[model samples]
Target: MANTPAIGYKFDDISEINTSKDAWAVVATPIRLWVVPSFSGKKLPYSMELVLMDAKGGKIHASVRQSLIYKFQPLMNEGRVYQISSFGVEESRGDFRTTGHGYKINFQFSTSVRLVKDLPINRSPYSFMPLSDVALNNPDSYYLIDVMGILTGYSEELEFEKDGKKNKKMTIEIEQDGVRMECAFFGNYVAEVLGQIAAGDKNNAVIVIQLAKIKPFRGKISLQNAYGSTRILFNPDVEGANSLRQRFLEAHEPAAQVLNHLPNSGKISVSDDFLKRHWGKTVEQIKNMRANLKPSQSFSIPLEHNRTIEHNKQNALLATGSWGMRAWILESEVCLRPPW
Candidate 1:
């Protein structure tokens, strides 16, 4: 049972409360948390933002001003449920309201938070949008989406400028049920991903992001963090993460086994044109090229010719022990490279 409420306090659903009121009890889970620092990069009274979901399947944005953060920070834990009361309510602003609710919670120093024990935490309150349904052609600019998938790969962090402002972003590739897509994380999310990779905690993990905005690039849809409203959970202790991990492992096992026997399986940098030319071409296509070959030339002659211009690149990558031409060698009848 939850802690007994104060005498005058009464429970209220987050969906029902709109105006500035007092003494309403609300039991909700804190799904997301963010600390906003002052503009000068100083710690001058940082404010906090939270996305909370209640038992009745209602979600709303919540805020704790800088003055009260110190008093409430210790009591607030993301993913934990609490019975709270005596908080202010204000009409949620458009840019800040991630949920559809008309109002948001405003916590004060006098607000009370009593942790609710013995109940299973409900981490996911919204239905997730599949990668297949999201597309660049979709007209909904403000649509928020959730995604759960396996982290297949990632690119190096890129810094670029737009509108006379510099920003950092990274592209993350995620796959679900044979569908692969890219998502971009900006600012703090970028730092979080880099930190996890640095700590080696991202080796075999599923990433789940909530409330991401879908933006299109080059005719493809890309998910981006929705700033204050988005929540990211990496390898969370939830059933969805476990299921994704299992599926990812099962799907990659065959490739993993092949890599285990092949020491130099790392990819060498190649242009998109190169991959688009060779990656999906059947062995028959290369075999057909045999007729165009000179009588004395080996079947690998064309491949070697393609490599001639990239000789320095090949040598550089090979010297660093990261290039693997063996896969191509094994799959092809080309006699140019020695059998590994």
Candidate 2:
């Protein structure tokens, strides 16, 4: 039971605790383990043990206290995700002969926040972060190889595990004229590149790389950016583009909260005249704050002047000019989506 504390969890921080630990030591232990997540709570006072993957820094387990159920007894269906905040624990006292040895923990659930999804960002595996932050109007029709700069140098490297239990990961860094970003040619790709580097300097081994949605940091450009690049697909890696798109969708899929927080107020029967008067003011304020021009920031504007104003997520309620383009304020710039 004393060793149950070290079950399977590793503590992130242990600088705050004052405790003496010895190998095969029989000592008093803390029995409570706490977890913060949106729990459906079908299993109350559940029988669970923490596994200590590391003897150096193991995580604490504070037994959960049904503070909510004890107070109001609301019906919480099992299988729902919950987010929790703070918690605590309890230890065993009594001696060996009379009461025997045992310790129990006490945990508390603080606030309940819903989970959200990621945003929609598309890109490639080889192009994980390969896009350079450049503007191209007719991007889709061109070859990305003609896009980015040349390759400069590359080096073989190793990726190490924290515990030193696993083998060092074999890696290579392909340096382009931009930033020396990495492209992994795993499995068979590793063997092929190994021979090329070993044979001589593969200095002339130049490949055309397409750049998109590149976030700038200093002057050194990095290859293959995922977000904002919009997954510009060129030749040789068209298959990779599809995979990149999937990842983008997965990463940026809106968190439930982000979507729910979107302004669902305003009216439906919005006309141009109504939009002209109201949209100008609202759009003006949004511009001042420098909100990213997203579907959420869109307002209807008529060809003649500012017309009727109706706030909504999207529909005819939001399109720009005849191009059906919607203004998006990203980071802090007003970017038009489906720009024509």
Each model's total of backbone clashes: 0, 63
- Model 2, position 235, has a per-residue lDDT of 21
* TM-score against native, each model: 0.61, 0.20
RMSD each, Å = 18.4, 24.1
How many collisions between residues are there in candidate 2?
Answer: 63
Point to the candidate with the largest lDDT. 1
Model 2 RMSD to the real structure?
Answer: 24.1
lDDT of 1 by residue, 1-340 (tens): 2444445556788788778555667878887787877745686646888888887778888889988888888887887788888788887654234677777788987787888765445555655776777752353434467788777777777776644567777767677767777777777677887677566566556778788876543355667677656776777775577877777787776454221111211221233223332344444554455445554555322232124211111121111111122223222332222223
Candidate 2, 1-340: lDDT as tens digits: 0212333423322222223331121111221112233334465633322211112222232233344443212312122212222333334321110111133223335422222122111322232223332322212211122232222344453433333332222233332233334332322333444565566433323333322222212232222322111222212344443444344345443341121111211121223423342234454564544334465655544532234433333333333422234554443444545443
Q: Where is the poorest 10-residue window by lDDT in model 1?
A: 313-322
